[model samples]
Target: MATLADRLDRCYSGAIYDVMRDMGLRPGVLPRTIRGLVPDQRVAGPVFTVRGRPDPEVDAHTSLLEWTGLLSRAPAGHVIVCQPQDDTRALMGELSAEALKLRGVRGYIVDGGCRDTELIIEQGFPVFCRYTTPVDIVAAWRPEAFDEPVTIGNVTIRAGDFVLADRDGIIVIPADRAKEIIARTEAVIATESELRRAIRAGEDPQRAYLQYGKF
Candidate 1:
């Protein structure tokens, strides 16, 4: 049998969202402001959460420590779901992305700006962020915590939750519920596939939806 992670790797964010909703889970989706740096890049992995904010009190030495610490701690096969409370600085760049990739980290979902996007895209690293900027964290930002619950848009994301992202958007499924959700999502996909075939054969969409309960 395929693992939940493997099954989820084959699932789309939209299908996963519907499955989660059917499970009575909110399907915590990051806002539309975030988008993939590389077109068609998709990521599915357990999240390693990071939360940070702008702190005017920090100086050069402390800033160096902060950046290095966050970068070094991310484990392999995990998506870095970062919440940088201050949106001015670019929290991710080419060099950091390179390190994460080498460490086997899957991708990034940042609720802040990112820089060196051209190089990041060139490296084929999947990074979804609010925007791109040339500004950096040297002057005013520091990591507050990691592996902690953080909110993005209206969603509350906890460390270890599964993150699935594509051009559509990013969605977080609670870690404990991922397996069940994936199983149901596979069934949902089968139903959708059947519905597609019916529609192509000239079946009315309304009738197909009525028969399949999905369109």
Candidate 2:
């Protein structure tokens, strides 16, 4: 399987942005809680996603160790995308990030909060989440599920879908539509590039946008 980086290079992040715009999704940074923890780090990959919900039963638990095991064994170049049921509480922290980095995992995307933002950003590991908190998971939450469909913002993410995120925002490309999206996104990029060049060369920006469908 092609790594996320490899596929992204072919289609380009700008192209993905175009697709997202075409789909009527507003692009904004996910909440600041998600951050990177490695030097010069950015992660892009097909999402091996999981979702979790709060459980009152203390015994209803899924071990992070087990999840790390899957990360370690995952095919090289895949990302572990996680969606937490509770957006207000931190679910991942420095320890979990350290294990993921060591396992050669790409990065994480969560719709919830995370701890250790400073260390994570200093280390340069890429994480995207909703908020940051000082909370821990000892009694607050549990990882009760894996490899399931999850929602982040307005996007529905499935276990095997392709995810591309950067400074702009994250875009989810369905597994079955990957190839088609890639092709369309590439075309959008080319069109926009030409329009940009024309505008830079003194052509009317409005005319360019009207002709190309985007500025």
Candidate 3:
């Protein structure tokens, strides 16, 4: 059997949203402003939550130490989702992206800005954020907590909850329901495939949708 990450990577955001809707689950989507670094850079995995706060009084060296410590603490095979309360400076940069990627972090998503966009793009590390900036979190930010619930848009994301993000948008599934959600999404995709086939085979689109119960 494929792992949840493997199954999720094969799933797209739209179909997942549809499945969750049919199940009456909240559409745990992030804000539209926060988006992937590169086009078609889809990411799906269990999330490692990171939250930060402004610390303007801290010295650069101390702030950097704390930041690097957070980097070292991140585990492999998980996407890091951050809620940096500060909005001006970037929470992620070239070295940070490289370090996380080297350490096997699947990807990163932040509800703030990012820096070193060109280099990060060159590295091909998936980073979803609201915008890009040259300002960085040197002495202005500090890691507040991890694995705590953080709200990005209308959804509260907890650690270990699964996320599916693509060109359309990002959606979160409660950890307890992730597997079931994926299974349902796979079934939805399969049904959609059959629906497509019938329509292409000269069947009326409306009739095919009625026959397949999906459009």
Identify the leading candidate in terms of lDDT: 3
lDDT of each: 0.89, 0.66, 0.92
- Tally clashing residue pairs in candidate 1: 0
Off by over 4 Å in 2: 1-5, 9-14, 20-42, 56-75, 210-213
TM values, all candidates: 0.94, 0.76, 0.98
Q: What overall lDDT, based on C-alpha atoms, would model 3 receive against the true structure?
A: 0.92
Between candidates 1 and 3, name the one with more favorable lDDT: 3
Global Cα lDDT for candidate 2: 0.66
Q: Going through the candidates in order, what is the number of backbone clashes in each? A: 0, 9, 0
Per-residue accuracy of model 3 over 1-215 as CA lDDT, tens digit each: 88899899999999999999999988798888889888788888999999999987999999999999999989999999999987898989999999999999989999999999999999999999998899998888999899889989788999999998899989998999998999999999999999988988999988997899999
Name the runs in model 1 displaced over 4 angstroms: none
- In terms of lDDT, the poorest run of 10 residues in model 3 is 35-44
Show where candidate 3 strays beyond 4 Å: none
lDDT score of model 1?
0.89
Give the C-alpha miss distance for residue 11 in model 1, angstroms: 0.6
